[model samples]
Target: MSEGVVARLRQRLRHQADLGEVLAGGWTGLGPSELAVRPVYLEGSGTVPLGELFDLRGEPAGRIRFEGDLARADRLAAGLAEGEVIVEGSVGAQAGLGMAGGTLRIQGSAGPLAGAAGPAARRGMTGGELIIRGSAGAETGARMRRGLLAIGGQAEAYAGHAMIAGTILIFGDAGPDVGLWSKRGSVVALGAIEIPATYRYACTYRPAHLGLTLTRLRARYGLPVKKRHFAGRYHRYSGDLADLGKGEILEWTAE
Candidate 1:
């Protein structure tokens, strides 16, 4: 593969910036100069060209990298339909909102609704992979229709709220009321979690799919996968009985 583009932040942001347009579809063919001219919205200052905030480098090869402390950058990779995006630091809310394809990898924490649908949209991420190496805020994958969401660290409340169909893997502690109102999907909890009352315990078994998914995560992302995780059994709970009741929560049991 050719060398992908890199955009390094010029300095710490003074106000939150909306970077939803930076790496959206059709960016893979654009050169560094063409891509840098795209617009971004700032909280108090309105719109400004991306070049003003980030120093663009390299050429687009179906991949992009952002190096910075973008804690105030919101919607960093929203509406992404293809290619690969890598963020080297923490990001603000709605990091991968409405993504359809490709991969969005964040090396640090993410704010609320990281992979969820926008207020006006009908669904969240429909396809692709969202990998967060650090913690994630509340409603991480709310209203998702499809895709894979993996969090390496803790996930706050409502991690997979109202999920339509998808898979969410949380490696650390999952906050209260997880998978609430989900219609069809899977929430895999590797650590502590409190299953909601709407869900009923089903059985403890070693799912064949679990091993396959865990193996891929370990090989591709370098996640901390242990022998226990590979051989351990999971307690399955089916729920959101209030909804379609097809959704499930799989809590890992120690060997």
Candidate 2:
């Protein structure tokens, strides 16, 4: 894919911005001028055109990159249906809330609920890929229905709470409730994790599918995938006996 627009922040934002409408449908066909007209909602302020905050350039390629600090920007790429969105720095809460299709890669950390549902919705992401290169705060993939949520660094508490389906890959330490109430999803942890009491220890075996997934993560994100993880054994624990209990947590081991 060709490189698309790069929206560099013009100034340090004093208030949080709701960039939910910045990448509306058909964004791939819009040039810099058209794209700059998109709306941005500022907290404690009012609405403003995207041009006021970001300097936009480049052709209408099917991808976009945001440069500079965006730690107070929320709902970015929310409900994204197509194209690729990349954030060079950390983002505020709900970074990719309820995205249906496409790719969202955050080069830096992310705040809470990166791929979780919105406030009014009960279900979270239905499809697509969410890649967080840095640490993620709590409930990173809450109530996810489908797609891949990968955290290259630490995942805070309740990492994959109530996921209906899909996969979560955590390369660093996982906090509490890795698979709290997931129904049929998979939580793959390559770092330290505390198994939940509700989960039943399943088995110790290497799943052949991991080679492909980990390889993709390594190649696509350069996430420091080690040699041992390619063919290593993982301890499986199935749980959330509190719910349907079909989900599983795969903990990688040195043995």
The residue-by-residue lDDT of candidate 2 on 1-255, one tens digit each, is 558999999999889999988875668788888989999999988999999999999888888999989999998988887889999999998888888888999999999999998889987888989999999999988999999999989999998899999999999999997889888899999999999888999899999888889988889878879998986899999988888999999999989
lDDT of 1 at 38: 94
Task: Report the poorest 10 consecutive residues by lDDT, candidate 2.
Answer: 22-31
lDDT of 1 at 85: 89
In the range 1-255, model 1's lDDT, one tens digit per residue, is 676989999999999999998877777788789988999999899999999999999987988899999999999889888889899989999999989988899999999998899999979999999999999999999999999999999999999999999999999999999999999999999999999999999999999998988998899878888899988899999989989999999999985
Model 2, runs deviating above 4 Å: none
Candidate 1: the clashing residue pairs are none
lDDT of all predictions, in order shown?
0.92, 0.90
Q: For model 2, which pairs clash?
A: none
